[model samples]
Target: MWRDPGAPADSFYEIRPECTDVPKSRFRIKAGKTLSARKWHAAFSPEGYLDIGKTLSRIHRGGIHPSIRGEVWEFLLGCYDPKSTFEERDEIRQRRRTQYAEWKEECRQLFPLVGSGRFITAPVVTEDGQPIQDPLVLLENNPDGGAIVPPQTPQDNNGMGPPSTDAANKLEKMTDKGVIQWMLTLHQIGLDVIRTDRTLVFYEKKENLSKLWDILAVYARIDTDVGYCQGMSDLCSPMIILLNDEADAFWCFERLMRRLRGNFRCTDSSVGVEAQLSNLASITQVIDPKLHQHLEHLGGGDYLFAFRMLMVLFRREFSFCDSLYLWEMMWALEYDPDMFWLYEDAEETSDKSEEAKARLKSIRHYGKYERENMKNASKSSEEPPLPISVFLVASVLKEKSATLLQQARGLDDVVKILNDVNGNLDAKKACVAALKLHKKYLKKAKKP
Candidate 1:
């Protein structure tokens, strides 16, 4: 029932990236010996540089060396151009740090109570320098006493009526209202942060927990439209742990959110998760009609059960390390080779430098399908890149088709089956299956 933008309302199928066997890496980074800082620097030179596409492909082919993850991820997340020299990137890094600090400062000013971890009962001084009692605290302490008394307004030295004007009172009321809303969101963020990655030892420290809270709070302040959402804490926890730098983690998380922000929108007009669920339904119907029919029979044609999976990109469904690996691989596949050329000036090298040349060539050459689509491009250009997560979800459902068709009598049964998969999925196997299914879907989509 869901339609891709610009597609006919009746059409249920759309093309997505095809699945292919990912090549195994020859230069796998190991624990102690990662892609060194020196080697990373050498990748960029004046005449010719390392083929970023090839380098990232190689990283995806094998896992990133543990030691180099922070540096490599900065490149992967678009924090720096792969071709940028060390000096260029260092300048960019400093500027970004300053920007992040400014945003954090704005957040602090907007929500001082939450940022400073002050109790709600803390006295608020008025413009006249008079301390006002917190009404809620007063109520709590004197529940059995007579009616509560409001704080007395400050009088002038003449001991006449309070000097506070109506305008001042109005401004104070507005500030109090804003603080209340901020406190509510801050409370929810704290709750989610505490539960985010408790299984990991890093979150055991209270300071680490506070860091998670700060990033999410500031993000909420920065993007008031999306504001704070529940599952965001889960997405941010791993970044904080992996990057170890608060600003860097925030920027990485921000880059990720650009792709995922739609999922968190709760407005009536927002497509968000509903559109994705529709994509999953359409994929299932085309690839495995029987399984699709079974789900439809169970009153799950909407496929809402997979909501959590899409929301946090399967963070809960896989182990910590596996989730990170899956994310890196997905990013690699999603990498737009054109992005490098758009951001950097290509330099020619001698024929002897075959490797760099090959990478540059690959960047220039579009896939056959992509070229054909571009010739007839329409509103499709406006669509965001198809996230690999949808196909990944489809792969999981296909694997469980038999069980679902035979055992699932209702929606609850379907939820139980998918829930059982948590912590049991093999990251590599899922990626392969997802790619294969994507390939199959694209082939079918291309046919008359």
Candidate 2:
């Protein structure tokens, strides 16, 4: 967590007047009887794109235009469906249904692998070397099951073979251990299955969202206790669509699920989400005190914008392709594919474990540096976090903060600031600024 800068309450930071000036002829103005005007008009029109379709493709093959950035971004991000033909749509639907069926079957088959057969008890070591309790035994075990010996008569209870207290303690201990192993097994297998599952990525069609929803619903049913949450689908949907290999995507999502399961624990309270939000708020306060103050004043500074990012791992804010790019970058930068599950200190005899641990520490250290660098870069650019929309919100204010401070008189001023940014800000620049702001906050948070 980071400390907030003690900025004066009455006065706020000001933007230089030079920063507020809109340049003359910022965008070329159309004039009657002008060739440039005619060219600009034609190029900017939606229908004009049809006329120079091949030419547009050729130019885009080299690079892309800023004018068509939004559509182009959507397309690149796999959120756009260029194949509008009837046959193509039907094919996508057919493939999607098949994928769902295949997923269901896979889950059914995988169930046995996760079940705890006749043994009914799995050994687990606690830090203190005491056997922990299991919840399943307490849940499913019944005195009527006939597995337990009959209780002694009142006369025999006066001198039973074993004391009732000892018997109860042993039962409780067994129950705890059973539940722990059950949970651990569920965690491990669930992660493995989700990580490997994959499906077609063409589910971005509005109608396909419901089908995608169904797939996630099935996962929730499989584990009703955890059920589903906002971010799980966001993470799973992309993998299903992009990989086109259900098993592969399932396992990948599974691996992610293992690490992230804590985020979705349905114990009635959202403690995990709150803690993350608090951390984000603290970081923001430390790095960009002015922006933090503005948000706090505006009633938007508790880091609510980060909720989706933290939950979905940045799926909603970025296009699917860009999200993948960012995710892969994050995974590569932060997690080691080869050294996963290697503990910091373990009594393993394998030589590879030693090698893995060294690599693990190096990667962990490197990830910290990379995260800090990324945060700094985003702040310098006055951007927000790529994974969270708040950075973009903060950037708009930062860029226009001076103007806003001068123009805004109170809460209405903040509202006006938000109003102006609604759909008017460039997503790319906003993303850049978000990254800059994150780094800036992180750096400030490190100060004594």
Candidate 3:
């Protein structure tokens, strides 16, 4: 497991005053306006070829306006192909909604609270799939099959009326293991959902909180491999708030987890973030040897302190609005034209990976930062699969490199140096620094 070093998991971060500042009437404002609804409409040709290059550039430089962010995120997250025509995308969207509906219906059948605009704060089933008949839980039936899971043994059955034969048989068909695993995660999802974005007015509505729970519960049921993790609520809440439609938000969150779920995968011995931590170690060692050595001497070489930032994409470090802005910018800058294809056939191996690397040199729709990185990618000794976010985190580290080297006498100090950065970092500046550091690192990696 990745060691969570400091602060309770539920703690909130403060936002900088600049996040709420009046819009600066400057070039950036005009540049950002280029991504307005009108510009977005114009970006598509008559046949609906999205000018992804232009759109990506605009988002990277100026970030996205709130009104169009969710839509733009659909493309950025690879939910829809930019190459697809308008009609094709519309068809895909409808099909995905139907598909999501099916997934939700499946979960609703297993658990009554799904799509009920209410969520449970306690587990409704025990580890062995026996229903927890708590008055607080109030387990009910799915109209089609009725999901009151039959108690495994009579001793466990507390005078409950027998389930209808049809409901019992339907549940019997499901694997005992799958049912237990899904059932166990219900309350964890609920607990996280209520606490997620609570300080924001958007989540003050109980229905809104339940909506997030519904999306997450459905996700955990469908994605049994990763299941429900605490930080996932942080990732899902923004999607719920940004995209008004629950299914769309679910799909968007699914796409994000496609990229991020690896971080949550853990074993008794190790953590998934270790891979990125290794990459971050490499970047820091190469970029600033002195700072890296100082950290190593402080027993901070593992970079465990950065676990939260990578886990939740710096959600706690930046203000909610600024974090959203940072996400679009990072996604735009890291945008890959081949992401849709690659993600779909992710299990395919070596040959496809090589082909993708080769295509990077000539692809026209890649975002600004990725496009430039491709030119130098060959020169770099190694290219980590997910480089931008790690580099962005590295940029944040470099932002505090001096303080870290001077006063970070131990591991805790290193974490404190980072904690001080919470909410004060600038999204635009951090992104710019990451890109600069990326180019420099690429050049530095090429040797005689």
Each model's number of backbone clashes? 2, 53, 0
Structural similarity to truth (TM-score) of each candidate: 0.72, 0.43, 0.81
Q: How accurate is candidate 3 locally (lDDT)?
A: 0.74
Comparing 1 and 3 on lDDT, the stronger one: 3
Candidate order by lDDT, decreasing, is 3, 1, 2
Q: Model 3, 29-115: lDDT tens per residue?
A: 343343667788889899987888888877776766555778999999998767668898888788889999999998888876678
Query: Which residue segments of model 2 deviate by more than 4 Å?
Result: 1-201, 204-218, 221-225, 266-271, 313-316, 336-339, 342-352, 359-439
4-93: candidate 2 lDDT, tens digit per residue: 223211111122244333211111111231122233335433422212232222221222222332233222222212223335434544
Q: Write model 1 residue lDDT over 11-129, tens digit each, in one string.
A: 21111123122122222334332344455555666743445654554554554544456667766666665544667666766777898889878766654533442222222344343
| Model 3 residue pairs with clashes | none
- Candidate 1 — what's its lDDT? 0.62
Error of 2 at 217 (Å): 4.2
Least accurate stretch of 10 residues (summed lDDT) in model 3?
3-12
> What's the true lDDT of residue 57 in model 1?
46
| lDDT agreement with native, every candidate | 0.62, 0.41, 0.74
Q: On a 0 to 100 scale, what is the lDDT of residue 1 in model 1?
A: 44
Candidate No. with top TM-score: 3
Please report how far candidate 3 places residue 265 from its true position, in Å: 1.3
